[model samples]
Target: MSPSLEKILSEIEQLTPEEQLTVMGHLVERVKKHITQVQPKRKWSDLKSMAPYPLLGEDAQEWVSRTRKFADEHREGLQREE
Candidate 1:
């Protein structure tokens, strides 16, 4: 609808299908990179605001370590049931 978008579409129309696909892939990657750069890096503290239940004193590292230990202890017995 916009003049800039119309102009871009007209330019793309002149390209071969392969060329159009290449250009589309490049544009998609550029948009993805831009989005990744714009988003703020999340911190462990940010989880408190987003979580439905309180995290209290337990942080991500502690939870992961405990889970890994439990999984290691149970993995052999759990696999036998499969």
Candidate 2:
């Protein structure tokens, strides 16, 4: 950890329970504000047309099944040779 953060953490440890809770609340609010400013809300529509229909000229499920079948057959063949 950085020296500044380590010092701050040591100071926070000395604080009473109520003071710690107050500090935690302020930190949470600060983090929320930073996050909102850094990342804008996204909509599902943003992904529309990101990929053409069937995505690479092959149906998604068909591609997955084809790859899995190929992998399984290759594995079984390897096992038989063992």
Candidate 3:
């Protein structure tokens, strides 16, 4: 987990039992708020839209560099094949 999330959890643990419950309630509310704030704004990948090029700019450069490093086994070179 992130350091900030860990810190929040630590603070909740240090609170009295009643305060811990309140903290948990607040955390749940904040998480729900975050879900609402983020869910609709998220942009999932579109393979069809991404079909023309899977890489661009720095990503493209990285892809090319990694591809060159693969040598013979380019397709599965970077992956853990079954």
Winning model by lDDT:
2
- Model 1, 1-82: lDDT tens digits are 9999999999999999999999999999999987776667888987766854336667878899999999987997799889
Candidate 3: which stretches are off by over 4 Å?
Answer: 31-82
lDDT of 2 by residue, 1-82 (tens): 9999999999999999999999999999999997777667899999999998989899999999999999999999999999
Q: State the lDDT of candidate 3 residue by residue for 1-82, as single tens digits.
A: 9999899888878889999888779889989986776444545664357645544545777877887877657656557565
- Enumerate clash totals for all models, in the order shown: 0, 0, 0
Query: Candidate 2: which pairs clash?
Result: none
**Candidate 3: clashing pairs of residues:** none
Better-scoring candidate (TM-score), 1 or 2: 2
Prediction 3 TM-score vs. true: 0.33
Candidate 1 segments exceeding 4 Å error: 37-82
- Best-to-worst ranking by lDDT: 2, 1, 3
TM-score for each candidate, following the candidate numbering = 0.43, 0.46, 0.33
The clash number for model 3 is: 0
